[model samples]
Target chain A: MTFFEIMLLLFLIACAISIFFIKRLVNAVVVFMSYSAIMAVLWLSLESPDLAITEAAVGCGITTLLFILALKKVNALKEDGEADRDEHNI
Target chain B: MSIISEEGKKTLTSFSDWVSANSPDIPAEVVYPPKKDDHGHGHDDHGHDDHGDAHCDAHEEAHEEAHEELRSSAYEALHASDAPPAAPAAVTAQPKEKETVTEEGPMTERTFVRTLGAGYRLIAAVCGVLLAIILLVTVAFLPRFGSAENPALNEVSRRYLEEGLTDTGAVNTVAGMILDYRAFDTLGESIVLFTATVTVIFLLQQSRRKNDEARALEEEDLQQGVRSLPARVVIGIAFPFAMLYGIYVVLNGHLSPGGGFSGGTILGGTLILAHLAFGEQYTQRFATITRCTGILSVALLVYMGLKSYSVLTGANGMESMVPLGTPGSIFSAGLIFPLNICVGLVVACTMFTLYSLFTKWKA
Candidate 1:
């Protein structure tokens, strides 16, 4: 893979991993959206603009909104001051 | 069409006939409630600025009648109950229409049905490692990516590369191949989407109409300043451009990388954006479930009918009469142009329907 492609892949992997590990559901959903956006970029790097467009539109846009809406319905809210207070990490 | 009175009378008479034919029991007058103020629907307490279309007004009137009937029945039930007359007064105080969010707090760890022990975690890790090792070993037997002599890429890719241009009269080989060569596969996939939409509707048939909890959250979001004015303005600016670009991609499918699926999804994304920006009421006004189903039905019918005709004609060794226009131009592909539109419409409706159904599913 090219340098930029490798970097994007690494970033995507990191995002996916972090999404699994995140404690708060909202934070994990945000990470998942980022992962989808990066995955779209990866599709673009592979010279498939069609796949990229679909990934960006459906995965990141529609899906992220759906996730957030579902979360709101289930009240996926972290308790006040119960989550991690470490400001250094995302 | 000249004068408001004449046009209104025309639409009104047709509307009355439609109601009588649809519901012979309920008289037309009972169906259309008294012509109230501009805000026609009784449940429309929220000051929705009515766009002065006669069709819209008629829809509101229908809703208003239904709302009134529901209210009168509720009052009768309250009166019929054994409780005191004062209980009915209390009943009037609690409006179920506004009861969106339940009085419940956020989830806690204790709410989980069960928690895994350390021993189970250790066993899961071991099993995951074993599975990963087995998958890795299997991967080694697979052919390398982009190899010139890969088995999967031998016959089909060669033919697609060679005769795709002459056979399809399209510059973009992928589009030409998918839209013409392997059009059957596309049809199957589109049918799968339509089936999924129908399945969702069948499963979540009688959910409460209001996507109440989600709207409650949005109202809360607005109150807490979660939604900003600048973001709304930005989306307003982007909406038209996004719509134009989506149509452009679909129309130029034969000349570009994107086709019906991707372009349709992009269009669906715009509708989702509309929901996020303008709220469910606005989105529902335009992309109602009934309207989405109608559009989807028509699109699928066209796609299936057109493709079957082409396939049948091909099997009979009778070539289509329409001449394939000059390659690289907009009208180059004979059937692909209209077929792409059909696919785009089906996909767009499918996405919208899926989102709406999921968001509103009470089950």
Candidate 2:
């Protein structure tokens, strides 16, 4: 495979491995962010820069912001921190 | 504990022997993994170690004891109950794995076939519907070649720009035509916006009814929590500037790209932003004034159209009541300035109404 293809494959592998093995929800969110960034790069390489930019903006910017907001909101609603923290890490 | 029991070893040995005898062409290693432990019997073990003997003798003793207890319970239940089935052993041993596999395998295939056939039928039905829609749309629009054109209004401003502008002094042909030539249509459009705004306000007022009912019943259910301070602050800060820009766009539309409709929309957007920043209660506070503005703007537009045209609606060649002023000046476009103002007001009101409806409905 080409160098870029090999790198993409490696990223895909990392995402899958993290999804399978990672236990905390927040850590998984972080990995999901990486996955989205890699996907945007792949899209850019495919020469669809408009779609790539939109994907990065929406996937990594707005959606991530929304997720963080929701996380904080839910965290505020419930007093328990440790249980959900580990649950999120997964 | 032994990893593989003696009985398991015997079973394995028999299974290997059975494979070797039944299909000698198959490799021995392919049929079974190499035996790690040795069994005493060298030959005839395949037939000798029967299925029952393959199970541990200790498990057999435990099964025997459990079976005895089960028999006592069955006897007691039978004496106590009114009805009993004929084949008790048939019911008891029904879960035998070999028997289960043989009976269930065909039944499962039957179910799979039935479901797959149903799925295919559903797919065919959906495809047929989509294909019909495609055919209908394609056939209907085929005659026009997909170009649906609206009828053009009479072209009056072509000569007005070349000849009349020198005397009328209106530089912007569109503004000259709208205000001087067809001020009535602009006024009508403004009125339409105003009416739309009123309708929206009326709709939003229903939220008060809801709030009243809530207070009557369960006020506790109301979400009285404060919104994010950052969101409120940002929206509040941005609101005034957006409204001012919208006004600028509407007022300077004749000079640039925007018009009354565009400006009104911007103004409406600003109001909506304000509503979003503040709570529904703030909207209710200003509801009356919004409603009045909406109604008055429409009334003013209607009055102007009627007074200027003095003819039936939708008729062409209405007389321009006001004289066109100097070219490139704000006043030069006769009725255009007033028409734009009307348009701006209508757009603003309509948007405000729509936003109000949304906020009210949400509340």
Candidate 3:
């Protein structure tokens, strides 16, 4: 494989692993989004433009937005001030 | 137990001992408060009643005095302190009082549950590791990527490529292969999207009914979309062009790399952006839930009917009546173009509905 392809694959693996280790849900979602974006680029490099487009639009865009919405619904996306107050109360 | 050897038994016992040691400490006195009284009862059963009666009376008097001392000390602490230390003391005392009653009552059951939980975790870990090893071994045996000896480069792909354009009358072979050759698979995918949208609507609507105050709060939030004037202006200017590009991608599926799913997602994203910029009320006027559902179902029905006609004709050894126009023209590939539109509509509606439902439920 070329250097770029190897780097992309490494980044993908790192993102997947770090998602499990990341404590913050929002940060994990962002990592997952970057993973999808990288995979879309890999799809393009493999010469399947249709698959690349679908991956970019669905995986990177719609899925990430859906995850963020779900996070918001669960009240995981709290403001810093609110979180500090909660920690103080605890 | 017989499955474990002597060494395993020792290791298991030691592990259990470590777990118990590392677990949060609950005072022994709280856990076994009635043990002393139980010993007294046992002695009374073996000895004279007069001696047992005197011992029980002395025990009761000592318990009452201890309770009085505890209450007086707590009162004094509450009155004299700044309340932080007293708060922790109360928190600790409350749980101990509750645990003394409940723990004594269900001691056997609690141990059983603890053992069950440990067994579950061990089994889950073992199963997960076994599955991962199996997957890795399978991956190791798979044919090398892009190798001529690969099984995937077979007669099926050959047929799709060699006769694809002449057969389907579309320049984009992948589009022809998906929307024309494998039309039923595409139809199933569109149905899946439609079903998902309907399910989300059904699930969220019930919860949506009881939260009028939250809904009003969300409405107020939605009205305050893209607070910066410049951002709103930029979105306003770019919205139409982005929408046009999405439509172009869907319409030119037969002639280009773009197709129903990708283009439809772009369109759906554009709609979401519009909602974010101009507020829900503005978007609602054009794309209400009722109207979107109507459009979605109709598109799906049309796609089903067209595919059914094509399938029935091909099965009966009859020629298709629809003409395959010039390959590169916009109006070519008779059913493929219309099918792309139908699939695009289904996907766009599903994405839009999913986003709106999630936002509504968030409130």
> Candidate 1's residue-wise lDDT over B34-67, tens digit each?
3545324432432323333344345445635544
* Candidate 1, position A59, lDDT: 86
Model 1, position B271: C-alpha lDDT score: 76
Q: Report every candidate's CA lDDT.
A: 0.67, 0.51, 0.70
* Runs with alpha carbons beyond 4 Å of true place in candidate 3: A79-90, B1-130, B226-234
For model 1, the superposed segments whose C-alpha errors exceed 4 Å read A77-90, B1-116, B209-227, B361-363
Q: Which has the better DockQ: candidate 1, or candidate 2? A: 1
Ranking by DockQ: 3, 1, 2
The list of candidate 2 runs beyond 4 A from truth reads A1-90, B1-170, B175-226, B280-321
What value does DockQ give for candidate 2?
0.03
Residue A16 error, candidate 2, Å: 31
Chain B TM, every candidate: 0.63, 0.47, 0.65
Highest TM-score against the true fold, candidate: 3
Q: Rank the candidates by lDDT, best first.
A: 3, 1, 2
After superposition on all CA atoms, what RMSD does each candidate show versus the true structure?
13.8, 23.3, 18.0
Candidate 2: TM of chain A?
A: 0.76
Clashes per model (N, Cα, C within 3 A): 0, 14, 0
State which docking tier applies to candidate 1.
acceptable
